[model samples]
Target: MIPDMTIGQLTTEASSRWGEIWDPRATRMTILLLCPRKERKMMELHGDMIEHGQPVMAVFHRPRAEAHLLEEQGFDPRAASFQFVNIATADMGPWMQQLVNNEGWLRSSIALNPTPFSVGLPSQRPFEAVQTLCFRHPSLPALEQYFLPYPAESLPGKCFVSLPRRAAAEMARQQAEVLGVGRLEKPQPPAPEPAPEPQPAPVAEAPSESQETEASEAEEPASQTPPEDTAEPPAEEHVSVPLPPTAKPDPAPAQAETPVPLPPTPGEASTESPAEDAPGDGELSGSENIDLPEVVEEAEEISELEVELRAFFQELIDAGVEPSAFMDDPRWEDISERAVAEGLETWPILLQMTAMG
Candidate 1:
């Protein structure tokens, strides 16, 4: 008959049964186990141990099957590690029940459905069917505040002591920041291309010299002269300077005083017309049109870049990374500009900086 024993008892019994030998007095424990999820928590605990002077050798990896199982359980595969699965208190299994219900053991039993693991012995021998054993170390007590209702088919396994409250909280915050920074979604489809605009009909030049001359003459007179009904310049007046004492006065007869015209200033309108108003050899003719579609395309490209930059900044904020930190850095502009030139997005650049730092 299978013995009904607590997981700790089973492990102790198995260690002896498997002939494994190790010094318990060692300051550090080498833990090689299967941790399908809860990697962050495990890492936090590891860090806490180091901080408290107990160094540990820990290796954790998710089995391919376990990851698939998480998805089947309606947990978002990406977020499963950070979340909890409810398990009934009664479902703690026979071994755990015996351990938790024991009056002598001051161990607290809470509903924390942490991932189970198959351990490696000091000799590195694999523990087969580790799932069948439920170990409860005195050092690793289940907290009452984190209790949850057990989900169907969920079973209890080994429960390790969680990091101290403050340490756990700090770890949680950092985990959230990392998740926010790394999250990515499907990119939207490209916008539809704009329709081609109608081209203006090409203007035909007059071939006959007589017709060209007539057109030129007509354009010249209309453009050069001001309208007669409009204000005309006043008749020019010449002011006479007073005769010097040594100079002779005019002896000619005093006739009607005719106004002498003043010289025109540089900006004043001239009555004479230019040779022609026609387009020169290299210049575009009056009938030529500007390609509006090309200008619109450039504007659209700039607008898209602006949108991408805004999204990248929002992601930085959500991740708890200061967007101003990057913005204030002199290299940020160069990095973004290079990304734009290569047709790459901004989030990759932001992610790289965080990873490097």
Candidate 2:
């Protein structure tokens, strides 16, 4: 009979034994055997099979059921082992159930269905599958939220129980179909060729001073020669007109218009005209000079704001968020509004920056 083991024990043993040989591309199933640590021969036999590239893994685990006991011994209760399998083929359900029932040497075990794109030990399949299932049934309120924080194997029963009858039946049928046949490997599409780097345009060299001088010298003679069509005008005959005498009395009448300057008023010294105290055409007044500094400061503030917004956008990109999706995120609404207020093109501008980079 198989002995009982906690989820933590199974994961700890599976990871320590078969961690290095875990290949998502080829590994179809992982079998954790709850056996004593002294079973070196069985472990060695499985290691040989792994070296030979078999799709099976048999790992020996020392069973510890209590979470507190496991933690006191420095074991992680949340670690999980995942195996990639093609859902279309691979008879996973029956074989795992049989292993659980018949094998006395196999103490405890669990099977995981890894997504096609999963790599290494961490699997996103549970969360992805839950989200997809929720989309198909809108009545389900984001089921992934509950499962994402725990190990995939720890909550499989609860996850299955939470599914509606129709979904559960469909899941069972799919599982049966997957377990009955062997998976055929699909051909991967070829990687795209990288674009070639652009070459710099060639610049034309300026003519040397000697060459310029020679060109001018060559053209000098052509300029100096007169056109064949040019001709001088004939001289005109001159005739003098009789002179008329001028009157001199108008100048005396203009001298009477000049008035004597006003004397200084009481308790006031004589001053120059107000126009003399005003600023010259090229110079600024004190208020105007102050305004120039304010204009400069406003421009500086705008430039600084632009720099900060660009940096914030870049940080989001670095965190693996796409610029096009920024509008969909509520956390970025304030930033988006600010960008609009500042007349920024937002996502399009970030897209251009990303492409350039």
Candidate 3:
């Protein structure tokens, strides 16, 4: 029978027996409880660890067969809870060692029998009379402890443990059910809203021949009108007499042909100044119109950059890396700098994209 012990005692015992096999430089530790798959029991143990502030990273359900293979294959479980852990500490080895040492509730919760499993037994076989615990690390041998009195009729499942932020924990629960591991106790995530489709730029159409003709015809009447302030003699005042043929005998026909000037409009000035009629320097003329093409080109460039940024985030997701946790990676610096230069709200955009996913 396993003795009851506090978290500190469990840590000390584990360190003394397996310290040599532990890698101090490792950033993560995987703990597997080979107990019966009972939701109530799993929740009790998870809640106890949380109540004691044990840095619980994540908790989910998986087939016992699959959980056992994790140690041998070294494959990532892709649990979302691990995203909350800050893995960028300088002395990750010591930090992880400390984490292992503090898992007293974890040790007590699964400690069933004092004897380890016999060598060469197929791990795939159902637990007949014993339960086991495993502490797996990358590049290091796994540390295991055995427990007794595993009920024969208990279902075949294992509770997987890790850390999670509040929302991420809820998501993990949902994923566990969706993947057919946990009880169908949580609701699936709602379908994501579709992303807005990009609209094409407007194309400028050339004027047709008929439209050009109508425009030119509209301008002819305006051009024919006289200036508003100009004065001219009435048609009635310019009558020619029948004596016009004989009038050519006048002494000087040139003097007689001299035109008469008419009085200016009542309130108008007689003096003309070309400068007063022309457009001022401050006013934009037809030749000095805005450079609209350059503005449109800039907008298009920003749109393309946004698309590229979204694709970069998608690549991270596909690779099972959390976008928030990837900030310390070298590749992120370039992306961040470019985003800042373009005035993009990187985090907001990333969150929106991830929500859709």
Provide the TM-score for each candidate, comma-separated. Answer: 0.16, 0.16, 0.17
For candidate 2, write residues 1-357 as lDDT tens digits.
Answer: 113433334444644534443233442422322223343344334322222322232222222232333345453433422121111114334333433454422232222223333223343434332211111111111111221223333322211001223433455566667786444667999999999999999999999999999999999999999979968798897999888987666554444567789987754543544455555633655556664434444444446556766777677778888767755766577876787887876666677768865
Model 3 is weakest, by summed lDDT over 10 consecutive residues, at: 79-88
What lDDT, from 0 to 1, does candidate 3 have? 0.45
- Runs in model 3 lying further than 4 Å from the true structure: 1-27, 32-44, 51-165, 168-235, 239-357
Candidate 3 deviates by what RMSD? Answer: 50.8
Please give the ranking of all candidate structures by lDDT, highest first, separated by commas. Answer: 3, 2, 1
Instruction: Summarize candidate 3's per-residue lDDT along 1-357 as a digit string, tens digits.
Output: 122322233333533433333233544333343222332343334433332212332233332333344444443333211111112233233334533575422232122232234433243233444443343323233333322223222212232222324534565677777788868457889999999999999999999999999999999999999979867767776677675454445475454567779876754543443455566643646558756664554544466667877888887888888766768667778888988898887888788878887
Candidate 1: minimum summed lDDT over ten consecutive residues — where? 146-155
Top candidate on lDDT is 3
Clashes of each: 9, 4, 12
Residue-wise C-alpha lDDT for candidate 1, range 193-227, written one tens digit per residue: 99999999999975999988898999997898886
Reference-based lDDT, residue 59, model 2? 23
